[model samples]
Target: MSSPEHKQKIWKMIKDIKVGMLVTLDNGVPRARPMHLVQDEYDGTLWFFTRRSAEKVFETAGDQDVCLSFSDQEEGVYVSLSGKADLTDDRELIEKYWNPFIAAWFHDGKDDPDVALLEIKVQMGEHWKAKESKTFQLYEIAKANVKKDATPNLGENEKFGG
Candidate 1:
């Protein structure tokens, strides 16, 4: 099990990254698509809205294993989440995560029968975050080169599991 601190760190790194690359296997071939993250609280589960007839739905049905990647290059934060995906038609959850922006895609709004929720129960996650500013990073590089020292510390790299 992941510690609360680790989970919180993971959430903090990904919260601002609204878009994630959801990777699913299509007949043994890996396929990835950008998905909008719907939930704020992590709690080891991530939710995404999609259509019932989407290729990802069929792909996930065949194999539940999935990967979600979130990156913010400016902030130098990257997170990779591995999990199992389950498709659900639960209206309550759909409504909970629904927003006007998402409604544009569903045509019929919250009542759209084709609306499906991809519930990704996260099993494990790895994260890399750079704590220093870009300018500071450049300074470190220069200092390392001038002094022939090892590279400077580059924030954190961690792994967590639920």
Candidate 2:
């Protein structure tokens, strides 16, 4: 299980990523697609909006296990989350997460029956963060080389329940 502090850190890393690669299984083969993160909070779950007719819906029906990967290279943060995906047509939630930007895809707005929400019930997550500045990283590298030490601190590597 993740402590509240860990969850907060993970949330901060991913909240602004905006886009993530959602991976699902299709006929036992891995298929991935870029998905927009529609919600603001992390809290052990993630929300995404998608068309009901998308292939991922069928794929999830066959296999609930999925993975979401988020990265911000400039910030040196990356997160991989494993979860079960569920599709919902709850009108209230659809409206709650709705925005003008999504209208281009749904066309008919909140009332569109084809618009579906993907709720990922995250179960496990792993994250890597490089907390050092560029100069510090360079210094560490040089120190390691001079000391003939192969181990270098590259920040935190944590695994926790989502």
lDDT of each: 0.90, 0.89
Candidate 1 local lDDT, 1-162, one digit each (tens): 477777788889899989999999999999999999889787888899999999999999999999999999899999999999999999889879999888889888888788989999989988998889988888878888888757776788888775
Residue 62 local lDDT, model 1:
98
TM-scores, each model vs. reference? 0.90, 0.91
Worst lDDT 10-window in candidate 1 = 1-10
lDDT of 2: 0.89
Model 1 TM-score, 2 decimals: 0.90
lDDT of 2 by residue, 95-130 (tens): 889987787778788787789999998889899988
- Cα distance off (Å), candidate 1, residue 110: 1.7
Tell me which residue pairs clash in candidate 2: none
lDDT of 2 at 60: 98
